[model samples]
Target: MAEALANPELRPRLEAFDSYPDATPPPLAATEELTIPGPHGPVPVRIYWPGGTPSEPRQGLVWLHGGAFRFGDLDMQEADWTARNLADRAGAVVVSVDYRLAVEGVTYPIPLDDVVASMHWARQNTADLGISSISLGGASAGANLAAGAALRLRDEDDWKPEHLILVYPSMHVDLPEPSKSLQLALTEMLPAMRLPPEMFHSMRENYLGALISNPPAYAMPGLADLDGLPPTLVLNAEYDDLRASGEAFSASLAAAGVDVEQVLVRGVLHGFLNLSTSFEPVDDAVNRIAGRLRAAGQNP
Candidate 1:
């Protein structure tokens, strides 16, 4: 970890996250709140429609919020900003899903079920929302759910997203044995943030339920067969702990004949996308995602 701290490039990125500020006021008008039915119960969703006018049916995105599955909701400033930005920039109706968190239910299929249900609801109401196609994306564990939901949609419902965007996603359950660079980065940031490994393990256990010998491929989409999946864009932080898994997942998608693009931002860490006001990289990443969504299905 000392080596990671010594690297000038890594120190600044960690500092940026440590110093991130609250999000700015929303620039676009959001739709009235709505509740989508979930398997366990009703999951709240906030649909953001920029300018509140459906000139033409636009693309749609069902966005999940990040929290290691134990924290986060639709109301978080970052989540709200993401929804607004995606809607205005991508010209898509962005539905921010408030799936049940781990602390409340703490089990497998619970979070997954909520996301699937939300997508179904989104698809069913696409006409009202003026959306033509649907896409999935999220940050961190939210990204995990997004990937898993896409796989489920494909396998069970034959639903294919026009695109899949993951922002520093937690794609693998078990952290790869730390590489030299990873170890260095952790050493520098962990002490400052005081994030414990056991806490992360507990979060995993809470989301996965009982410790099964082998979790399903959908649980870890990086482990799943990526063939026939949608075109993907993965934005990763150069110094994030999850960088390796994100990279590996991109490789898997490419190997499966899926179109995949990756943007590795130097001097950044996980969850940076949420700090749009403070982090320039966050807005840059969001714009890039919106551009991709705008271009999806246009040429090919």
Candidate 2:
């Protein structure tokens, strides 16, 4: 992203996520851009509704996009496509959240706060929003935020999400082994899949100052308490360095006796979720998520 910003030719295309990229899988019946008040400012959100008569009381989802807490937007191709597809597949109203990014050296808790606030806002207006059951889905950095919010909600005696949908979540900021890092660094040369081990260090710094200070475990889900959380569905990519951590997190959740299911997609790397066109695995992952949400029912 830094390099993209440096080159004048690519800056606009990189910054403007709305008209940036294209991916066609399924079309949404309706799309809406709306906002809710936040501690920082008005948080922008995009809503997707499936085609057909709305269900008696719509099932809803609160989605967070992944950009390492600094790279994504509501209009980004992956975010938009996932929202639309989930709306169509799950028969639920999907709300894609555009929370405050931790750019310019912003500290921890802000992004999580924004997400939790958005959930509160949505829940408060559930009747107005025409939704009964609510679930949470997020990818990469968004997954981190979703899990953190789930923890917060559980601790506060707030309404827990019916389920958690996480895709390639960056759960731990720890450095990988030299060989693993080398493999990740080499894989970036592959077409369309981008995951650099070094970037994780920088992202951790950018999001939460220095690791020496040791921020709360919520900043990194792998270090947090996993008990009393919502049922979680964690999806990981085979070649992703973060896969190890995500899998460990899942195991921890299971050990804690929390309901958890994890799927490891072979022959793919981090950011695989965004390569639906180039990769066939994306559809299977999406379908699995939708099916899980559908089975979660209107109230669970």
Candidate 3:
């Protein structure tokens, strides 16, 4: 993925997809595009309020989109369709952050900073925004940011979240011990692995940028202090390279005495959440995500 990010030939293709994700996403009760003030500049954000009318103030979730930290934007299906569907299904307000990606000038902390800022914004304005409970959620790269932001909130700011939602997330800078020893044909082409090793390498470099050699724990929550984290739901894909890492993080969360729920969606690959049209399981996954998030919010 990193190589693709740097490949001049693939840049245009990536931009085109970012500009035109699933153009015909199902119409939702409500959608709004607005900007949130950020340290660098105004950050664009999309909001979805369940049922188009909050009958009453509802729970809030600050969402982040995944594109290996180098591709995608608000128009991407992960941010648009996912947010809309989750909002309505959970009957809560969903706010999707168009965080700055790790492009030429942007780097690690920048993307993670935007995520934390958005969370702060959502929490502070919940009342006026008709939001009651506040949860944090994301997919893939977005999920990494959500986790990173949560750790930052807890450690640096003495703040904490009530619920967390992660999907096929990359939680560690390094692969699990078991994955390190395994070798496959043509890179193995294992039953549950979709991406090539080179892709993961490139994507990781693209995300961290050239400056940072030793990425801090906040850059990868798997390395962070996990004690005191709130309840979390981890959704892992059956055939994703990061599945083991995500599950490991979930295990760590449980070990820390935090309530955690982990589930593996069978017969699905990473990025399935945005491929609902091609994969039937995606619909079921989204529904499960909505239910998990709603349950988290309704808890005291």
Over 4 Å off in model 3, which ranges? 1-27, 52-55, 178-193, 210-212
Q: lDDT for model 3, on a 0 to 1 scale?
A: 0.77
Candidate 2 or 1, higher lDDT:
1
**Residue runs of model 2 more than 4 Å from their true location after superposition:** 1-25, 175-197, 210-212, 298-300
Most accurate candidate by lDDT: 1
Per-residue error (Å), model 2, residue 89? 1.1
Clashing pairs in 1: 1-184
Candidate 3 lDDT over 27-106, as tens digits, reads: 56778888988777888898886765546667788888899989888877788888877876788788999999898778
Judge candidate 1 against the unseen true structure and give its global Cα lDDT, from 0 to 1.
0.79
Question: Compared with the true structure, what per-residue lDDT tens digits does model 2 show for residues 13-85?
Answer: 3343213224355766778888899888888888887778873877889999898889889777668878877
CA lDDT of each prediction against the hidden true structure? 0.79, 0.77, 0.77
